[model samples]
Target: MEDFYPSRISEKPQIMKRRDPVIHTDRKHDHEAPLTKDQLDFYEENGFLQIENLFSDKEVAAMQKAIFELQESNSCVQSEKMIREPNSNEIRSIFAVDQDDDYFKDIAADQRLLDIVNHLLGSDVYVHQSRINYKPGFSGKEFNWHSDFETWHTEDGMPRMRALSMSIALSDNYVHNGPLMLVPGSHKYYVSCIGATPEDNYKESLKTQKVGVPDNDSLKWLVDQGGGLSVATGKAGTITIFESNTMHASTSNMTPYPRNNLFMVYNSVENKLVEPFAGAGERPEYIAVRKTTEPLGKEKILK
Candidate 1:
């Protein structure tokens, strides 16, 4: 309901989009295939990988249509997981679509996605969370520099950093449209808060709908050691996979172009969650799933 601005951005200048080598051209695949040795090595060393044109134009269109329809429907409005922009009424995010509709559920269980997750996380992975982010033109705000595991560990009670997130571009992510940026090789170090503890930070996230950001010194050190920043940008079908502990951020979309992406977090079945933080039990099923070990089926494959 309120405009949530990160403390770090108060004094900082407008976040600039970096032009690094975060987009991959050679690793593209159409069907379900395991990651190549080079892809694995890159992911291991850098903590992130980007594959271009992994999904077909037709498949992206179908998912995009579903998203638009759902956004307009009354069901999505009542779901309470549909987050709005800080100031405007435009929809910013829709969480846990798998539980609401069959289209997203099939997409969630697609073998093409599962195969890649298996390669990175080994077999027996379950969906920890799934959502579609809408970075509407001129209004989408910046996501601050933060590790997803920090929130998952502190708020959702995730035991370890055995999870990873896959972001599928439903709309083209251009440099001007707030494409995700990551500091390569930053996953090796779990940067603890210089200010708030994990629990206290989780409370802030609940109020603001944004994660706790890394301090200025920590961000500078990470950029210096991790080989600088790289932005993920590509066509609608491109997919970006990153480790849960990777330090990542995105700037505000100032251009007229809107960027939309489907984000899914997959966790190893062995590393289930515990309710450590207060009010964790009351969290919705769509935001934090309770099911475990349900590997997605091979019903929907992108051609």
Candidate 2:
């Protein structure tokens, strides 16, 4: 497959039009929780969809407890799966949450999520990455603006924009806190950032990303093109699904409220990863799964 979306190999940033669809699915499904037609239209036009109160209070509480347990667990705190803040011992993110605990694993395999993923990608999907992000009060840092597809293609070798992000709010995301902000229609374009990929870049980028980030001019242009930026603010149990190429970021939390988000990124089975488009060695399995390309379930649905 060709590298349709390339990044981090030039001295000047390149703004290229996206050649992929925002929503890849087009078929009937028995998914009780499938996105409605209006929701599908919204995503195709805006690159994101937010559904409030999708999960129940009980489910949200359960996940919250699981997160606290994982945070207190010695194994997560002592392992490489944990990503700390730049200087402090604060846990910025816990990678591969689905692999770490049965609670997360069950949530990952939940039929509603799986069915919706199937409807979105038009195929059975597998988890490309999973993590729980924590932004403690007064200490959470910002995530700079960038497209996940750009990094995935350049570093992780995701050949196409057939992937999407499914993030559930584990805590109330407020304006005062570092809630996610996304460009409304940013997935229509790709930003080819200017930088050289350093060796073991994931080690640093997993905490703070410098390379593959959109430049100021490019961000301005995208905002103009997208109409404006939209903040994802919702109570716990709110669910958001966005295109993989959507331009999104978060601010540094200075408020007393902590914002925690659980991410389960799904990729089309047909769009499985390959060698890095930047011509480097593959990243670790924990960052990007390469060994297992199996479909979400035992077999492909909607085939």
Candidate 3:
């Protein structure tokens, strides 16, 4: 239709040929096996854990290509601050889809991811929501400290609610390259200082800032109380698992490169969504999956 995303014609291929870790990595079976008793305890106690080199080089290539294609077409919206729109024009951004893609389809069948979720929430889990994020150099914004569950928590203190999250880094992320950050064990608190007022919107207020390198007192408190700004730095294709209540955020893209990643959320079958900031009662683009008949493996089914 109309040219929404400003097209940049470059001699370089649209999708980088060699699969730059700076851009994407391949999906692979990770060493971070489904949680042992120790890992489960660690997760319970710490709120988050890391899986190194979870994706292979090839998988990263395909995912990166797909994301770049999406970016070129303006299917994503990019901004420095958090402002919700039905659609956006930014190259590096997230999308709500009614259809499935190869990447997500593969993610849907990933046993290891399911196994971890099962350990935490139980086997009868469903894909509550998924987001594709591309953080481009100089333009990518910061996602401040917050919890996903608090943003859309159902009433009645539902058990096994949005239980867990799987975040895959599509590209090599370094401290300067704007990696994700988290507050260890913060999820156990079950509270999120989500900005209720316009000024309180962390994304809006801290648009032009970086995490891990705090410049103010509030930020210093956040860094100190937690791991004191633990950078989610890792090789390309790393996947991190965290409780849904985990307080996490990402640094700003200060370097001249971009950081692209995807975040997927799964809810226990019994849980439903209740949007806190419905914004004039407009429904956000979130979809639920049907309960599948496939066996979720013993590892996934919580005892």
Q: Identify the leading candidate in terms of TM-score.
A: 2
lDDT: which is higher, 1 or 2? 2
Clash counts for all predictions:
0, 0, 9
Residue pairs that clash (backbone atoms under 3 angstroms), model 1: none
Per-residue CA lDDT of candidate 3, range 110-173, in tens?
7767766654564456666566777777767666665554443421122233457777888888
Root mean square deviation (Cα) for candidate 2: 2.0
Can you tell me which runs of candidate 1 are displaced by over 4 Å? 1-33, 74-76, 194-211, 277-282, 298-303
When sorted by lDDT, best at the front, the candidate numbers are 2, 1, 3
* Candidate 1 TM-score versus the reference: 0.81
Give the per-residue Cα lDDT of candidate 1 at 260: 90
Q: Which residue window of length 10 is worst by lDDT in model 3?
A: 16-25
Residue 41 of candidate 1: its Cα lDDT? 70
**What CA root-mean-square deviation does each model show from the true structure?**
8.2, 2.0, 13.7
What TM-score, computed on C-alpha atoms, does each candidate reach? Answer: 0.81, 0.95, 0.67
CA displacement after TM-score superposition, residue 278 of candidate 3 (Å): 8.6
lDDT of 1 by residue, 1-303 (tens): 111111222343222222122212133431234777777778878889998767788898988887778777843465467777668777778888776778888887788777777656654678899888888788888878888876676556666667889998888888878999999987777655433333334334632534346667877888898878989998887899998888998888899988998889988776677763322343556667876446666532222
- Evaluate all candidate structures by whole-model CA lDDT and list the values in order: 0.71, 0.85, 0.52
User: Stretches of candidate 2 above 4 Å error?
Assistant: 27-33
